[model samples]
Target: MAPQGVAIIGGGIFVKEEHLPAVLACPQLSLKAIWSRSIKSAQETAKLIPGDASTSVDLYSSDSGEGKSFDDVLKRPDITGLIMALPITEQPAYIEKALAAGKHVLAEKPIAKDVETAKQLIAKAQKIAAETKATLSIAENFRFVQGYSYGAEQVKQLGKVTGFVVRISWSMQTDNKYLNTAWRAKPEYQGGMLLDAGVHFTSALRKLLGPENAVDSVIAQTSLIQSYLPPVDSINAILKTKSNVVGSFIFSVGTTLSAFDFLIACENGSVQAEGSRVVTTRGAGQNATKEEKTFEKSNGVKEEVSAWAESMASGTPNPQQAPEMALADLELLEGMLTSGDKDGARQKLELQHHV
Candidate 1:
């Protein structure tokens, strides 16, 4: 299959530092262009690419090619797909435009603010698949992370996935001096911390447990405005699925330590991942066994790019963390916030699941 030419929109810090390098490392994909919309962003990212690159007005074609806007980037004749890393509020519009342009898309998580918008995006994605056979995927990199990928194997050998737990937390060292004016702190931009960071836990939940599974019930507590930022500081929830699968999750960004993303509780065994280290236990109390699996820290962005490139090239979508998974997670997140135990009343999972 021919290499799919990808264009990355938004030259944000995450995309430039994390994703751009990943796209460059993927042998199957070639970055055709980029659209940052700022001279500073365009120029800053221009230095990261290795070929004969140049800066333009927030939009640039790789290898010293012509410049274009976000719309132009989607409409370009040579491009095959778009890699979106824009703010959550800005995501749907671009995804819609890209789909309308008949291009396959890979976007960041939390498809939209509410369940209905997410459903709209999902419908659009389905229409794209039905009409053009192109599809949309989310960059839930945690599922593709080296540690979690290997941990799943241990869970399989231990037995069936009966239950699970996840604690995903990270510390931000941003200067508060400019935070008030920053778009990140605003709900409109970042979609709150859970949508931004906790999303990893939700997506990983689908991966660690299983996709096509919806939350039958959930109990949650979210602390946001009371924190340093104008948004919620962190969220804690206990989720139960229709399959009677139960799990606890804590997704937080305003914290001290910057690690620990997962724990998978299986029937006969349990597995936990602290960064790259994974420890697995097997059997009952009398004949219990445990082993730790060590994996190297890989270039995550590269792996994601390779996977996306393969999907676009082969016209086949990988099952893990597919479109349905993203939607399920979004529904879970919405239910989480709405299901708060603040009023001492059990909240129902009101969002509908397509799966």
Candidate 2:
């Protein structure tokens, strides 16, 4: 099959650093165009697409105030898919437009700013896909990351999971280019840095625990230690899954300490992951056996982009990071925030059934 022609919308730091490289690496996808709010940025991003004249990437912008608009890109017969990297608040409308135009869409994570909006967008997109036979997916790179994949497999080896704990902390200095983005600094979305990056950690936890167990309820506390990050930047939650398994998570972007740790304790054994290393222990104290595995660091952008392209070509949705799964991730985060607002009172998580 010929490579499916796709265009990337939103020319930001992530687009330049991750998506561009992934698009170029995926043999199943052909880059056709780049769009940004600014045409100059679009042109600059286009230069990163390593290809000959036959593969020349077109540039368009919403701020151009002149030439082809976003709708024009959607109307292109040659472009059958779109990869959206816009702000969380700006994504849903574009997703609707793209799917309505009968174009497959791979959007960035967290699905939407909140659950209600996510449900509405998902409902509308599903209806369009049913009618037009288009594919819609969320780009959750953590699911494809080498370390997380390894950790998940090790978790399964530990037998029936009883409980787990996740801790991720890091300082976001003012010098960070990505954090300095206008939308991020003064995000219209809830939870500020927590909502933006916390979804990935929640997705990772969900992957480790498996789909059979849904987050049932949560009790949490939130803090905004970072003056620059409005709303909140720190979150600590205690969660209970549908299967009765309990878990705790602590995520902070305001801390000076840097750490990443996830541990799952099961009936027969336990699995622990610290950074890129995963350690599995089986048996009791004296008989305990330990095995360690280390995975190469990868952002999984290429893997996700490849999966999207293959799905578009075969007319099947890649179930790994589907929109529904992303919505579930959002529910977990939103539930925590809501529970925190209620002074750590347990809040039940509401999920929408996806066909």
Candidate 3:
């Protein structure tokens, strides 16, 4: 089969570092063009596409002449797909336009700035997809991470889930590259850094718990400890998943403390995932058996893009990257913030995904 030509629609940090490498690594995809809001940024990204690819890849931007604008990229017949990583609030319109132009889209996560917008985009995309057969796949790298999948499978085999705990903390300092983005610095969106970063954890949590034990509700207390990260930067919540299983979720990106792990205890054993490692313990104290496994450290962008390309080729959407799945992750994070604002009033998730 011939490789599908695709364009990248964002020329930011992640587009240069993660998406570029991922696209280059996928043999099924041909790097065709690059687009950004500025010509300089688009040219900067084009420079990273190595040798032969560099010579063939076109650069487009908002400032471009008529034939080299973003709309031109969408009008391209050879470019049948797009890998977009734009700012959260600005992505939906671009996504809709691309799909309407009959191009499959592998869009960045936290589907939208909030749930209502996400739903609207999904509805519009579905209508466009039905007409053009173009697809929308949301990118959530945690779903493709090997450790989380292994941990999730381990949880399923360890019998009924009893309880779980997710504790993660990291400092997003003044000099942090990701935090330096103008949109991220003074996020105009809801939940600020918490919404931007928490969605990944929410996706991981859902993956580890499996569909049968999907999170159903959350009651959380949120606060802004960092003067820089506005609205809120921390969340302490209790999650209730299917089958009445309960868990505690604590996430803070504004603290000096550094830690990260997700542990699920079951009737027969417990599985924990930390970074690229998975550890499991089974049986009673003295007689217990324990094992640990490590996976190659990766951002999971390669596997995710590979999967997205495969889905495009097969004409079947990858369930993991479905807009519904991304919506679920955003819904969970938004639920936490909504609960936080109401002083820990329980927020029930209506769109929780199963598996």
Q: Give per-model TM-scores.
A: 0.85, 0.95, 0.98
- Model 2 regions more than 4 Å off: 51-55, 352-355
- Listed per candidate, the RMSD to the true structure in angstroms reads 3.9, 1.9, 0.9
What lDDT does the true structure give each of the candidates? 0.69, 0.85, 0.92
Which residue pairs clash within candidate 3? 211-355
Candidate 1 stretches with Cα past 4 Å from truth are 51-67, 160-163, 173-181, 189-191, 211-214, 256-261, 341-344, 349-355
Question: What would the per-residue lDDT of candidate 2 be over residues 124-168, giving only the tens digit for each residue?
Answer: 988998888877899999888877778777777767888999999
- Model 2, 155: alpha-carbon shift in Å? 2.1
Instruction: State the TM-score for model 2.
Output: 0.95
Q: Model 1 over residues 1-355: C-alpha lDDT tens digits?
A: 5666788887777787788888777767767777775656766876787766434213553333454556667767778888888777778887877887888888877667777887888887787777777678887777677777677667777776777777767665456432443456666733365666666666656555543345678888877534555456666788887777878877766777565757777779888876477888887687988888777776355677678888777778765437666777777777776665263244566442532
Candidate 3 ranges beyond 4 A from true positions: none
| Cα shift from native, residue 248, model 3 (Å) | 0.7
Model 2: colliding residue pairs: none
Q: How would the candidate models be sorted by lDDT, starting from the highest?
A: 3, 2, 1
Candidate scoring better on TM-score of 1 and 2: 2
